[model samples]
Target: MPAVDPRLLRYAKATRVFLALSVLIGAGQAVAILAQAWLLATIITDAFLHGAGLDDLSGQLALLAIALAGRALLAWVAEVIAHHASAAVKSELRMRLLHQVVRLGPRWLTGERSGELTTLATRGIDALDDYFARYLPQLVLVCFVPLIVAGRMFAADWLSATIVLVTLPLIPLFMILVGLTTKQLMARQWASLQLLAHHFLDVLSGLGTLKSFGRSRVQVATVEKLAAKQRKATLASLRIAFLSSLVLELLATLSVALVAVSVGLRLVDGRLDLQTALLVLILAPEAYLPLRLLGAHYHASAEGLGAAEQVFTVLDREIPATGTALLKANRTIELEHVMVASPDRDSPALDGLCLTIPPGRVTGVVGPSGSGKSTLLAVLLGFTRPDAGQVVVDGIDLATADLDDWRSQIAWLGQDPMLFAGTVFENIRLGRPAAAEFAVRRAAGAARVDVPLEQVIGERGNGLSAGQRRRVALARALLLDAPLLLLDEPTEGVDPDTEGELLNTLPAAFAGRTVVLVTHRPALLGLCDQVVELAPAAVAV
Candidate 1:
């Protein structure tokens, strides 16, 4: 990320407003700094050298109080704005990221980890609080304060001003050098955190299976290793940050001391007035303070900058163009030399394959394990786009159709169906939320779901067996009563009796629909009007 990524300003309107406000606040703070310093110098010099009474210095002291109050007020306002701006920007980025993920579709997601993405959207984005609340305000001050302070010092004493100018650049120069190392360390720390999140989520998801296989301890050890790696990376980053902060502080302290020495020597020799020397001494440290603070806060924000970079990487991915035309009715579906590439495989999943399915008929697709059976269903269901050729409905190309409108006519059941935590009726009603109770029960009956409608299930339907979960998913799909239905191994992982029961329900369940069933069972193929077989290397009849 650059000092200020243009994408942040472009994506989050709140960032632009925050920056503009920060500039105003920085200018106010600069004025307050100069006022406070000048008032203190006048009060001290008048009281000590002129033998001024408390009454004579009272007015300067009062104005000095106002300047002090003004500076504090501005700081508070900046802090408040920084927090609000941080929240708004985070919300905007998360929403855009989610929408972009949806636009990229399931095919793009197939190559990525859900846990990594979860971490990015949640904890990763939250890290930006440091970027806004600490780093950005300091950055704004670095721009405004140093120049104003330097100019004030130059007016008071040119020799001291010259010294300040000569030494000020060194702070940022060394800061840049240290920042390079910090950036690398931060990147490593962030990568380790993401890896830990990914594997931890994977372990949790497969915990039950691991226990069944007596390998849960292996997964626990792996998670511990990942967690330890993340911890070490974090400590390493913090160590570098502390070392860099000390370096900045050392440079800033030395520069301030040098200015103090010059001002004191000039004062002793009567070359500089008491008031002028006091002002010069006071303003010297102010000139270097912002830059030193900037270096310190950069470490606090480095993780956020890294996360923003990843967010941009995902947002930059290209999605296929789509159209707005809606399908009117079930029509013959055609795949014209369709080709779909696989990121994990060198060969295309569906290579220049073409097929046609008559409307309102059950078509079975069978293939070997590595064949594109599921890929074919993904393409037909619009979750994956073909790299070559067209999927046409009647005469309209699917690529040109409004995907949402097109999907409105589709009722699909994947091999592994996801069921949210809810009553059985609620899950079935998900297909058509406005459907009446009778319609919901009818669909559930059609799919042979024996679970009580009022019975509640756990996440991913944990309360139900595999066969019951499939039936519930099938019921949800059936409830849609859509013109087209796509099922991938709907009878998979079931006993023979359960599979036969499911197969028996298919003909009536599939009635008056353009159905594409991907299964290896001969019994399922028997129910199809026409069967299409796909080879490992090609599509065949």
Candidate 2:
């Protein structure tokens, strides 16, 4: 794939007005610089050699001053325009990427690392700044400025202009040679970053487990090793970038030196005028300036390109549109020859096992750890699409259904509920943002979550006990007013007394609705209407 993604056209479309203005302003600056160089050179040659008057000198100086001021003003305006355009492009692309991921569904995102996704959304999208702000404008200037400068140079002295043209290819040639290494280095650097992200996120997610087992020191050693590898990869990338910059700069400088030497020889030989010699020297640097800057930024942008590739991989993944009939709220579920595989493993989590969830019944799913309990729940929740067979809900296939609508009809309470860092009011209201205060209170009461709604949930609900978090999650789901509820390990941490009270209170709230509760607790199972056992993979296989 090319470094510049064609998909970036979405961002390019975001601020067309500002982009146009930025280009115009940038070109204006080039024009100003060129004119000032021309005027000052002509004025110097006239006053020193041609014996021009002081008034003529004053007039030329005034013109030069105006050009300089205009260049400064245009440069400032260009910066303003470029900054806003870059910001708009970044914001639009971030939102677009997020929307793309969400629409593509869990099949694409579920198995991916959160930290890598964070890096992609932040630093990866930022690479477009180079593509749009630096590379693009320079690309434009590369066309206009160099051509204009070369034409002016040729007009002054075709001999020196030809010298510049001949040596110009050398810069990109060496840059290409250096850039070959750049691509390889960037690939390695990105891999290292992804590895670090994977490790870091895994560690953070399991930090509590590590502490409980007193193995945090072991994990710390592992993290240090990973960080060391990342540092080495980073240095390797920077070494290539610096080398690329050096090679490009050296080539451009050599070309300018050659042009200067030719112009000097011509002037000393009495075949060229002083003004023409000066113009040739000045315009020579202008011709190679854009090319030099492009080389430098290209290296910086390659890392971003690597990250974008990963993001594109997610967006491009095939999420089948099965055209299966939508499963809406009758609460009846039938699993026929259902099989779901672990994304990071070879074996199926739920093998070709059939089961039925009776409509509007409080059914319990019980199994040992790694015995396909949670996987079955994920499949029910539409997070893990089964590799084989049908998950039929209310006589409709889960695949073809309008997922958002199907999921909206469900109230879910998972083993570890996701609680954003905010007041409990916000977390509970997540089920329905427009839910009234009294409605929220009613749901909270039904879940037996005694915590005040005004209390803030710390990061990951660290402020609450395990049972409290589960209760809050149950409250949130209840606030949805959905007809069917899925609860995973709902009463695992609650005391037997609280668990009994919850089981008794919970069924009343469901009235005519259905509930599927998962738990290993005898206390919770006793209260359920039905109990289903999931055999181990060994037995199913």
Candidate 3:
């Protein structure tokens, strides 16, 4: 990532506002710092050199106290502003990133891993807290504070000011050199960390499979190795950051020393007054303080900067254009020469595939495995766009119809039912948020979900048997009462008895609704009003 990414400003409006406020606060802080330094110097010179009694210096002491309190207050305000800005930016970025990921659709996401994406949206983005909270505010102060202090020094002692001016460039120059080196290291560390997280999530998801195969113990070693590698990468990145801080601190210290020597020599030779020399010495370190802190905090934020680069890359990807037209009430759907190619396949998943799903009827789509049955349903659901084809619903081109509106008319049940961590009633209610309790119970009964509606289930329906979970999903679908119903292997994982019950209930449950059922089961096909068969390569309408 560049030292400053424009995407941060482009994507996060809150960050932009925070930055603007930070600049204002930085200006006030700069003024407070100057006042604090001047008063402290004045108090020291009057008490020590002029032999001013405590009574005589009371006013100066009070003014110095006020300046000190104001500077501390401004620091606190800057910290608070940075913290809120970080939180707001993180929230905004996560929301936008999630929305964009959904907009990209599953077709695009199929080539990506869920674990990696999860880490990116969660822990990866969280790393940016330091970037906004500490580094960014210091960056603003680095710009303003040094200039303010240096200007005051020039008025007090020109030779000391010149020395400070000539040496200040070295700090930033070395900082840039160190930053260039650590940038690559930090990127590697972040990549390793992501891989480690992905590996852990993958292992957790497949633990059942590994245990079934008696290889669970073997994976433990692999996980440990990956973890060790991640730790090493983290340490290496930190080492580089520490080295960079050391270099900045050394440069700043040497620069201050040179300024101190110049001020001391001038005061001894009567070229500068005691008060002016004391002020110059005091403000010299203040001029370099912000720059030094900026360098140190920059390293602290390097990981976040790297993650931000990947986030920007994702955000920059182009999504297929969506339409604004609405689906007609009739809901008759047609596919004309639809071709959807999978990323890894040479041939299209659905090539020259034409089909019609008339309103108020049931249509069964049957095909061999990988015959684009699911792909056809995906096109209808607006989850995947055809590369070469048109989809029309009631004479309105689906390509020109609002996808959300079209989807709103659909109640979809995939091969695998998805269940959240909630009561059975709550899960079913997800189909229609405002549905009445009587309606939910009726739908559950129709789907053969005989359990009490209040029974709670674990994530992914852990407490429910495979057949029960499928019925729960079916109950949810039945509750929706959408104009269109799309079921992909709805009876999968259920026993023959349960399948028979579902087949018996499905016709009445889906009465008067347009349905596109994707199934290979002959029993399911027997219930459809019409059956469409697809071949591996293509199917003619």
- Return the top candidate by TM-score: 3
lDDT of 1 at 135: 96
lDDT of 3 by residue, 1-541 (tens): 7656788889998977888998998998888788877888888888888999989999988988888888899889989988888999999899989999988877787788777789889987999999998899998888878888888888877788888889999999998888888888887787788888888888886787899999988989988988898899889888988888888999899999998887788778988888888788889999999999999899888888888888888998987788999776357788999988876567789889888888888999988987888888889888998899889888888888788787888899987667999999999999699999999998998888967889999888877888789889989998999888888888777788877887888889878898888887788887899999998764343
TM-score against native, each model: 0.93, 0.86, 0.96
- Poorest stretch of ten by lDDT in candidate 2: 3-12
lDDT by residue for model 2 over 1-541, one digit each (tens)?
A: 3644665554347656765675687678778878988988988899889899988699898998999899888767666666677788778768877977776655566667778788788877787676655665555566567767887888878888898888877877887787788778887888777778778878987798899999999989998998999899889889888877887898899889988887788789998889888878877898999789878877766776676677667666665564545666666799999998765556778888688888877888888877788778778877778889988887778887877777778888877688889988889899799999999999999889888899987777868898888888888988998888888887767887888789788777877777787888877776678888888665343
List lDDT for all candidates, in order. Answer: 0.90, 0.79, 0.86
Q: How would you encode candidate 1's per-residue C-alpha lDDT over 439-465 as one tens digit per residue?
A: 998888878888899999988998899
C-alpha positional error of residue 364 in candidate 1 after TM-score superposition, expressed in Å: 2.4
| lDDT (Cα) of model 1 | 0.90
Candidate 3 lDDT score relative to the true structure: 0.86
Error of 1 at 78 (Å): 1.0
Model 2 regions more than 4 Å off? 1-3, 10-12, 15-30, 57-59, 104-110, 126-133, 201-212, 322-327, 331-373, 386-388, 391-397, 521-536, 539-541
C-alpha lDDT of residue 417 in model 2: 81
